[model samples]
Target: MEELLKTLNNIRSLRLLAKEIPLEQLETILKKFELVVQERKEEEEAQQLVLAAHQEKIEKYKELLKSEGISPEELLEVMNLHRFNPSQHKKRAPRPAKYKYTDLDGSQKTWTGQGRTPKAIQIQLDKGVTLESFEI
Candidate 1:
């Protein structure tokens, strides 16, 4: 009974010690987290700058087209169709299992190419295939 009481007391003491975290350590951890957030924010800002540059280039292209007697409507159509946005497209399609294809090493390798049915990928789709098949 005395040994059990001592064990309980030791456990309680350990719990008390565990709760006593240093402010400096916490501040350091918080500082690291803040740094990560700042880095991510900077990366996003840089991406915005790149997109702005792309817009500027498109404007320049529009100007060039205008000089060549092309109408603004034609330029708008081209820009609308060709504008790139990374987030707008799906990265990959859902897969039930990884398709293992033979690599250079003669070993079974997972499919690196994007698509649903790997074997059914057609370079030029027939009229039967919808335009939606080309998306993402």
Candidate 2:
């Protein structure tokens, strides 16, 4: 992530260096971003492939269940929680838990994460600290 940010900053600096960055330079940066996007798309495609394979296994299991006279719904109930996105496994962290609060003065507010201020704090962030106190 830091490397990506550095690359972005370097690209911005390069753009600023030119009196007017040429279309070719812009295209180059666009191409880099496009490559990243393409990679993500491919990841999603691979996830779909895994999902298909899992579904195929489930179908085979269904056939076995049929042999035992099990109802389709019963089989589905047994496997309901196994349906998960393969793409999600390699992606960003899960969203933080959210909480809504009303202050003593009757103010309404909501925050995310496990902290005093609910901005969806990351694990590395200081726990239970309000946003104002976070700077320290």
Task: For model 2, give the RMSD to the true fold.
Answer: 19.0
Off by over 4 Å in 2: 1-20, 72-136
How far residue 120's Cα lies from its native spot in candidate 2, in Å, is 43
RMSD of 1: 20.8
- TM-score to native of every candidate shown: 0.39, 0.37
Positional deviation of residue 93's Cα in model 2 after best superposition, in angstroms: 41
Q: Write the per-residue lDDT of candidate 1 for residues 1-136, one digit (tens) a residue.
A: 9875664469676456446768787578669979999999999999999999999998998889889999989867988888887779877865543344444445654543455543333322333664354343
Q: Pick out the ten consecutive residues of candidate 1 with the lowest summed lDDT.
A: 118-127
User: Candidate 2 has what TM-score?
Assistant: 0.37
Model 1: lDDT of residue 92:
80
The residue pairs in collision within model 1 are none
Instruction: Report the C-alpha lDDT of model 2 over 26-101, residue by residue, as the tens digit.
Output: 7897799899999999999999999999999989988898999999998678787588858657877865536554
Best candidate (score: lDDT): 2
RMSD of each: 20.8, 19.0
